[model samples]
Target: MTYRRAAIPALIGGLLLAALLWWAGSSADALRLPGSVGTLGPDAVAELQRWVAPWAYDPPSFLDAGVQGHGYVLLGDDGRDRYNGIYTAGLQIRYGAVFAAFVLGALLLIRRLPPVRGRTTAAFLALWAWGAAAGTLAAAVSAPWFIAAAGHGSHRFLPQLASVTAAGRQLPVAVSLVAAGATVLVARIAAEGASTPPRTEVPARAARLAATAGTAVIALSVVVLSYQPVAAALQAYSPDGGLLAEPGDLLRQWLLLGAWDAPAAGAVVDWLLHRASDVLLLAVVWWALSRLPGLLTRVTLPAMAAGAVGATVLGLLASQLLRIAVVQTGPQQGLLYSSAAIGNGIPAALTCGLLAGVVATAVLRLSLRGAPEPAA
Candidate 1:
């Protein structure tokens, strides 16, 4: 039951999960071009060249045309269809593996720790570490697929080719870290024994209110910033010679600027505004459950599930409102166009909020469940 003993199972679970993710990710698509230019007609090759021309980083040339032609041969209509199927399947496998691994790892680790005060923190830390470790391993093992998919020709087409590749490669790693964090939260809550006494309700309520207020402020700010004129003004005054020339361009520029200046204090504020609701949803779920012990204890799973749904609904509503606001205040045509980006609309916000709420509920339950009864 010691940390040392518990770590063995954790390590094994992490390794197994990592291996599964790597296998799924790598095998999701054929890594190489499917065919060669020799198999295609000259006219077909010329059309393919035109299709990929915009993506080319260098001056248009016969060599570039050939390379692009080869790429299309590999990823023609059939290849595209196959890639989609494989990618979807891979995603399911990866998510399932992450979810199952976290639940199993959390239960295993929870049992090993002494049932004492502060064990929740310990459990959270353990789960977080395990998730991160597993994710890192999966990312490392899955590198071959991404590298092969990028191919030599991709470099010639994209100016920030290396950065793009790195970002692609890091997708699994980010997913793993997030999965781990959520698992820890859920496990922490579940580990709290059924009969354990509840803490004072006042503080939980207060915290929830404060979190709600904070979230509201940030969401409003984001909506305001998304207002086309406001966004244009911000971009114009920004240090990096604002790039918000066109209507839909503000959102893209904001995102790029945020990424480029992430280390800066201002960027941190932007990040918070972008993810305010998700960040605050933890407090909302925790307090809501605290106020309703029956929901927290008897229907724990259902409550968490509901929280996820609620988060999604709230996110969508917020997004819709923002869209309406943008349209009312800005140009009509590009009003809803930028909603596809993260922090700009419903999908990303809903996803982030749902995950956070579910995880927070789980961890809060474990934390509340106190020490296990001693055996005779």
Candidate 2:
């Protein structure tokens, strides 16, 4: 492999990760927002709020959504000071370790899968595994960090102690149902792929294409992640402030995309649109890798190139699901779950997914080399 081979991925992942941590760690409140204008403001609240929304869960009991969202945030002045501690060093290491684990774990899962069909079959399993693994990594890293950073990394203090409101309780069943629906969908997909056979090598052409694609993933992820600081500044300085504040309303303001804007309702729309953008981006990565064809000798490269697009979609969607599902409240902020919103989680998902997709394709390419040829 060329010296550029190693440098490409390492540089991308490293730089992207650094910028995100810097932004989140810079100000405690930046990671988490106190709240909106509320009918009433807590004298103890870090920032005054004329309005407040309940957490995802119904409140009345302190542990519910209402309190967690506002309690710590409204915890007066000393609360803010205590929230600003620097266990960030430890959290940084934790995030890195989990991400590395996901990448390596995915490769290991591929090595262990039974047998499968053509370039696409092997590629699909690999894509799914890589995506699930990447998402799992982000969840593992961020979830714990969120839980800990609020309370000296302890079990009893952080999210548990803060109080909440009762709005979330209006339909507790509905909230659980949404969460359950998402989990079931994710689990069903994972289980289906888990039953797939082990694949040992990808086709020669597929392998080459995957390598180039993987290289591209590293490059693309780096560029996008690096620009996060710019995105953050934009969201921060804006009037409504933050992407989710009124995404439908905010999106209308983004007439910058020319003809590509069609936003929907609610916070979930943000998820749907963000993932859609991610898929679009993955398509671009697909285009980038596809353009390198003909120079590489592998006949199978074309199919694998197409598969790269699928891999990109899977890589990103999986991460988005996890980052969103996991409870990610912060000290000064309500929920710092997404990187695009707060930490580098969104970028992490995008890049990590891309990396996994390329790796999966690469692995499929390796397997294709040894498998019997498909019918002409």
Best by TM-score: 1
lDDT of 1 at 344: 27
Candidate 2 achieves a global lDDT of 0.35
Q: Which runs of model 2 end up more than 4 angstroms from their true locations?
A: 1-4, 24-90, 98-136, 142-376
> Pairing residues by index, what is the TM-score of model 2?
0.28
Q: In lDDT terms, which candidate is top?
A: 1
Model 1 has an lDDT value of: 0.37
In model 1, state the lDDT of residue 201.
30
Model 1, 1-376: lDDT tens digits are 3334334444444554455444534532222234534565444444434322222222223223332223444445554544444334434444445445444544454444322354444444444433533332232233333333333323332222222222222233334444444444544344445444232232353334433433343343344444445655654542322322222332332222111113356567645454454334333433333332222223244333333323333333443344344323455323223322222232223333335445544554454456442221
Ten residues in sequence with the least summed lDDT for candidate 1 = 253-262
Encode model 2's per-residue lDDT on 1-376: one tens digit a residue: 1222223332333333333333333433322344522322344232211111111111122222212322343444454433433224334554465345433433332222212233333433433433333333443444443444344334333122121111111111112223223322332344443433323332446645665556455444434432445334433442343322323322221211111223446667564555555555455444434432222223343333333433443433443445445533345534322222221232243334445454645655565666785332
Give candidate 1's error at residue 193 in angstroms. 9.5
